[model samples]
Target chain A: MPYTDNTFFLYYNKSVLTETDVASLDGILSKCSAGKQFAYPMADGWYSSAFYFGKGLGFEVTYNDHLAETSIDCDFDNATGEAVTQAMWSYVKDSRFKADANDSKIAAGFNDGSIVAAVTGIWNRTTIQNYLGENFAAAKLPTYTLYKGTADEEQTQLVSFAGYKLMGVNNYSKNKTDAMDFAEFYCSRENQIKHFESRGFVPTDVEARADERVQADVCAKAITEQLKHSKTQKSVPSTLWIPLEGLGNAMITGAQSGSFDLKTQLKACVAAIEKTTN
Target chain B: MGKKRERIKPNVFKRLIFAFKDGSYATRLSFLVMGFGQIARGQLAKGFSYFLFQVLFALYMIFFGGRYVGHLFSGNLGSRLSGERWNESLQIFEKVSGDNSFLILLYGVVSLVLFCVFLTVWAMNVFGSYENDARLERGQELSTFRADLRSLINEKFYIPLLLPPFLGLLVFTVMPLIFMVLIAFTNYDYAHMPPGKLFDWVGFKNFQAMFSLADGAGFALVFLRVLVWTFVWAFFATFTNYFLGLVIAMLIHKKGIKLKALWRTLFVVAIAVPQFVTLLLMQKILDGDGILNKILSTNILWLADQRYFSLLPRTMIILVNIWIGVPYTLLMCSGILLNVPTDYYEAARIDGASAPQIFFKITLPYMMHITAPYLITQFVGNINNFNVIWLLTGGGPVDNVYYGGGSQAQSTDLLVTWLYRLTTDQNPKYNVASVIGIVIFVISAALSLITFNRASATKSEDAFQ
Candidate 1:
C-alpha cells in the first residue's frame, strides 16, 4: 500500500470563518489531532460541509482568490403575514410545479417532504432535526476522497466526496516510513473518534463511522446519508462559471423565457464543459 | 531590356521631390511640401517631428490598429481548432491553413472601393500643390496654416454643414458601430473569452449558423419573429402617438378648451420621466400580485404567463407609448398648428367648406410637410426604442427556446434586449450581438433614407395644396 501523508488539505468557505472561530478550532486541533497539519483553502463551495469542519477542526487555511463579501438578505424564519402570503402565492402560481389540495403550500403548514431532508452544518443539526422530526434519517458519507465529477459509468468502489481533506504522502520526505506510520495512526479509528467528537465530521475510519454515538448526532447522520448519494460538484473549469446556483438560475430563466432553446443550449453548455476541462 | 525600359520612365519620385523644392508647384502643394523639405533646408526640428509621426503611425499599425483591420478582413479563423475538422476531400484531420477564400473575395471588393477613394485624394493633393506653386511663382501670397484654421470656422462650408451630423455619427453611430463590427468575428462568449483566455477570429460561422437550418437555426427563427413584432410595434407606436398627440394638441389649442397650459403640462409629465424608470414602475404595477392585479383581483398574468404575455405587451406598449409619446408630438405640432394661415380657413368657410373638409384640404397637408423631417426622425426613433421593451417585461418573464434568450429569457425579447443579453449577460456573445446590431442599423437606415428622400423630393409637390 502507498504510504499516506498525515497532512489534510481542507477547503472552507470564507464567509463562515471568523477570527474567534479560527482560534477555537486551533485549540480543538491541539487537544485532538496533534502533530497533524491541516490546510484549509478558502473556496465558495466550502459553504456546505467544509466551513463547518474548518472552523471546528482548526485547519491551516490558505487561499488565492478573494471574493468580495456580499451580504445575502434571507427572510426564511420571519413567517410574517405578507411573507406567508408571498410564499403561498409563489407556490401556487409558479406554473412549473403542480400542487395537490393537501399540499403544504396550500395548507400553509410546516412542510415535511417539501424539503425531504437538507444536509446542514453541525450547528444546525439539532435545530433542523427538531424542526423535521422523524420524517428523515442520517447516515455516513461512504468515502473520504473528493473527486471532480462522476466517471462515464458508476463504480461502487469509487466513493465520492466533496471538499473533504485527506492525509496524503509527501513524496520528498526524508522519513518516509515514519510519515506513513504517523498518517495511519492519525486516521485510525481511535484518533478519528477524537477528531469527530471535537470537530464535527463523520470519522474517516470505517469502525468510527459506524459508532452509535456518531449515528445519533442528527447533522452528522444526515451528512452520512447524503454522502452515499454524493457526486462531486463538477470541477471542470466551465463549472467555475456555471456554478450550481447559476445552473439553477438558467433553469428558471429557461422556463420563464419560453423562446430560448434549452436542449441545444445545454448541449453547447456540455461542449463548453469539455473545452474548459481540456 | 530592363535598362532600356528604365530610360522611358520619368522617375516620378525624383521629379516630385524636385517639383516640391524648386518647381512652380510649391505654392499649390504647400500642405504636402512642409515637412521633409524643411529638414533638408536646415529646419531639422520640424522635419524630425514629421519623421517621428510617421514612425508612430507605423508602430500603431504593427501593434494595435492593424489587429482591428485584420479582424475585419479575415480574423485568421481558419487556424482555430474548430477549423481543423477533417475535410472530406483531404480525408485527414489537420490544422486548417491558408487565407479564407470567401474573405479574400470580400477584401477584393472593399479594396476596389477604397482604392478609388485613395486615388481621388492623391489627385487632389497633387493638383492643389501644383496650383499653389504656380501662384507662388507669380508672386501671389500663400495662405498660412492660421488662415486654413480660420477658414474652417468662417466658411460655413462642410464643417457647419456636417458638424452636427458628424458628431452624432461619431457618438451614437460610429463608435457603437465599430464596437459591434468588431464583435461579429471574435468568439466572445462564455467559453471563448478575452483577458482570461483569448478569443480569436471565427470567420462567418456566426452568420452561417444564423442563416442555416441547423441546431442554431432556431435562434434565427426567434430573431425573425421578434424582428417582425418589432416592426409592427414601431408602426403602431408611432401612428398611435402621432394621431393621439395631434388630436390632443388640436383640442387643447381650440378656443373653447380651458386651462390649455395646465392640460399640456399634465400630459408632459408622462414624457418628463426617463422611460426606463417609468417602464420599471409600470412593470411592477402590471405584475401578477402588483397594484393593478390586486385591485382587479384577476389572475391575468400579464407578465408571469407566456401565452398572453407575447400578444398583450405589444398592444399595451403602443397604448403606454401614446400616453408618454403624444405630448412631444403635441408640443411640436402646437407651434406648427398656430403657424397655419387662418385666412385659408376663413376663405374655405366662405367657400362653403366644412371643418373636416378644411382640415383635410388645408391643415393635414400643411402639418405633414412642415413636420416631415420630425415624422421621419420619430419613425426611426421608434424602430430603436429599447427602453420600453427592456423595462416593461425585461423582454421576459424569460424563455429558453428564444434565440436571444438562450435559456435565459424568452421570445418576447426584442432585438435590442437580445443584443443586451448577448453583450451584458453571463455569456457575452458579442459576435452575434454585433451582427444583430448591424442588421438593426441597416433596417433603420433604409427606413430613414426612404422617408428622408421622400420628404425632400415631395416638398415641392405641396401635398395639401
Candidate 2:
C-alpha cells in the first residue's frame, strides 16, 4: 500500500574517495532532494534530486527534517498526524540500499555479484556509470514493509534516511482524486518494475521487489542489505541546515587546526543546532 | 625698466629650453631626442640598454602583461578556468556574473598610462641633463643633479615629494573608503546580489535599519547594542596598552632597577613574536580542554558562555594584547623619557613637588606633548585591531538576540572583526564588509584629525626656540 520509495546506495571505496569526498557528495545529494516528490521517501543524496525533480517536473515534495527548508511553516499542533503516519508507513515499506562510487570496488563487487545493485546519490550519473561499467543493472527502491511484522517492528529499527525526497498532495492541485490515483498506480508493482528498469532505483511496490530485475540489479541488492540497518536522520521542528552547516565547517577547521577541544566543539555544534531549531 | 624686465623674462623654463637649442653636440641631440636621449646625454650604454628594455617591455605588455593586468580587474578570469558556479537554490546553478569589466579595464588603462608617464619623465630628465651639459660647455655654472637634490632637501621638498604617494593613498584608500561609505546607505543584503540584482541607492536605509528601534528585522537594534560594546572594547584596548607601556618604561628607567637590558629583552620577546602566532596560540590554550582550561577543572565554556562571554574574551584579549604591545610603547617612551631634561625634574623637586606630583605635572605634560601624534596613531591602530579579535574569540558564543547570518559571531565583535568576517566568511557580504571598513576609517580619521589640530594649535610658544 506504500505510495513510493526510492533507495540510494552508498558505495565505499578504500582507495578512491576520501571521507571528505563522501561528505561533499553528501552535501550535493541533499541539495538534489530539496524539491522532489516521489512515491516512497529516499535515503541521503535525495535533496538535489528532489530539487531538480520538483522544479523540473513540478512535484509536490517534502524532504527530511535536517534538510527541510526554513519557510515550511508546518507546526506540530496543526501538523497532519495522518499524513506523517502515512509517510512513515510508506518509507518503512521501502528497502534500503548502499553502493560505492569507486570503480575498482564496484568492479570487484560486480565480479563476485555480491552487490545486486549499487546506490549512488551523486548528481553526475556519468561518474556512477564510469565506476560501475557494463557489468551491473539498475532498479528502483523496494517496498519498506517486505519483512514487516508490525508498525512497532519497523519503528524500533532505524534506516539510512539521511537523504530523502517525498511526495505530497499540493493544496492548489486541480485534480486531487486523479492525482492520488495516478500516484498509487505509478507505485504499483507492475509500474514499479518499469520504473526500476529505466531509473536506477529499486521498485517502490511491495510485491515488485520479487521481480527478477530487482533480484539481478547490483546496486539494488546492496541497498536491500543496508535497508535493514538504515536509520533516518532525526527531524527537528525548524530547519537548522545553514547554521548546522556552519558548525560543521567550524568543526572541520578546528579539527584541522587542532586548536579547540573536539568535545567542546561538538557541544558548540549541538548548541548551535538546538538554538536555531527552537 | 623695460630692458631690465626683458633680460629677466627668460625664466627657469625658457632658459632651459633655449639652452637645449644652443647646447653642445650631445646636449642638442639628447634634448631634442626621445629614444636615443640617454646616449646624447653621455650615457651611451645606459641609453642603448634602456631603449632596448623599453622595446622588450612594450612587446611583453602587448603580448602577455596586458592580459594579466586585465585579469586583476576581471574576477571572472578564474571562473572561466574553474567553472565554479554558485548554487543559488540547491539545484539551480547561477553563474556569478557581475564581474565589473569596467573596473578591470580602468585598472589596465591606468597601469599602461603610468608606464607611459614614466617614459615621458625619463625623456624630460635626459633633456634636463643635456641642458646642464650645454651650460657647462658655454663656461656658465653647471647646476649638477646633486645640487638639485640638495636644494630640494633644503626647501622642505617632503611637501611636494610625498605628493605622489599621497595621491596613491587618496585613489586607493580614500576613494574606496568613499565607495564603502556609500554602500552603508543602501540595502545590499543577501537578497540583492550585484550585476544580476541591481541594488538601488536606498538612502540611509542600511544605517536606519541598524539604528532604528522599531525596524522589522530587529537587526539594527542589535547592531546599535554591539556598536556600544565595540567602542568600549576599543577604548580599553588602546589605553590599557598605553598605561602599561608607560609604567614599564618608567620602571626600567628607574635608577634602582637592575639588569634593565635583560628585563627589556624578556618583554621584547613577546613583541618579537608575530600577533598571528601569539593569537593562534592563545586560541589553543584557551580551548575548553586546552592547557589553560585543563589546569582548572571548572570547565568554563570560554567561547560559549553568554553570561560573561562577551566582556571576558574582550578583556582577556586586551590584556594579552598588552603583553604584545606594551614593549613597543615602552621602547618609544624610554627614548622620549631620556630626552626630558634633568633640569625640569630638579626644578620640580626643589619647588617641593612629590614623586607623584612631578610625574603628573612634569612627565605627563611633556610626554603628552611629545607623543600626541603617536597616541593618535595608537588609537587608530586599536580601532582596526583585526588580528586580536579574529584569532582569539572569533566573536563566538553567538546569542540568538544578536545573531547575524552566521553562528561564529557574537555581540562582542569589534567593527573590524565583524567587517573581516563579512568579507571572508561563508555567505560573504562584500558590500557590507566594505561599508564597515569605511566606517572604521571615518571614525579613525575624524579622531586623528581632531587630535592633530589640537596638538598643533596648543604647542608651547618656547618649545621651538
Q: Provide all candidates' interface root-mean-square deviations.
A: 15.1, 13.0
Tens digit of per-residue lDDT, candidate 1, span B1-465: 011123464665664554555544332333354444334334355445544655565575566545445545664423322235554764434443344423432343343344444444444344445444555456776565556567888884677779789657655665555555756766656554422234556778777655554563324666677787777877788877877788888888988888999998887888788876777888878764368866986535465344433566566666767767877888887878988889988899899998789778888888877777777777778777888877776665433223332323354566777778767775456677777877888888898889878877875644556
Q: Residue A261 in candidate 2 has what lDDT? A: 39
How much of the real interface does each model capture, measured as fnat?
0.00, 0.00
Instruction: Judge candidate 2 at residue B289 and give its lDDT.
Output: 35
What tens-digit string does per-residue lDDT give for candidate 1 at A27-124? Answer: 21222221122221111223222322211211121222221111221121122312222222232233422211111221121132323212223433
DockQ of each: 0.03, 0.03
Encode model 2's per-residue lDDT on A1-278: one tens digit a residue.
34334444444432333334333222222222212111111211232122112111111224443233233322211123222223332332222222112333334343443332334442223444555455323332222222235454321212334333445554235565566667667666687688666665565555787777787765666557655544343443232343333333333223323343334433443333333210
Interface RMSD of 1: 15.1
Q: Pick the candidate with the highest lDDT.
A: 2
Candidates' C-alpha lDDT: 0.50, 0.52
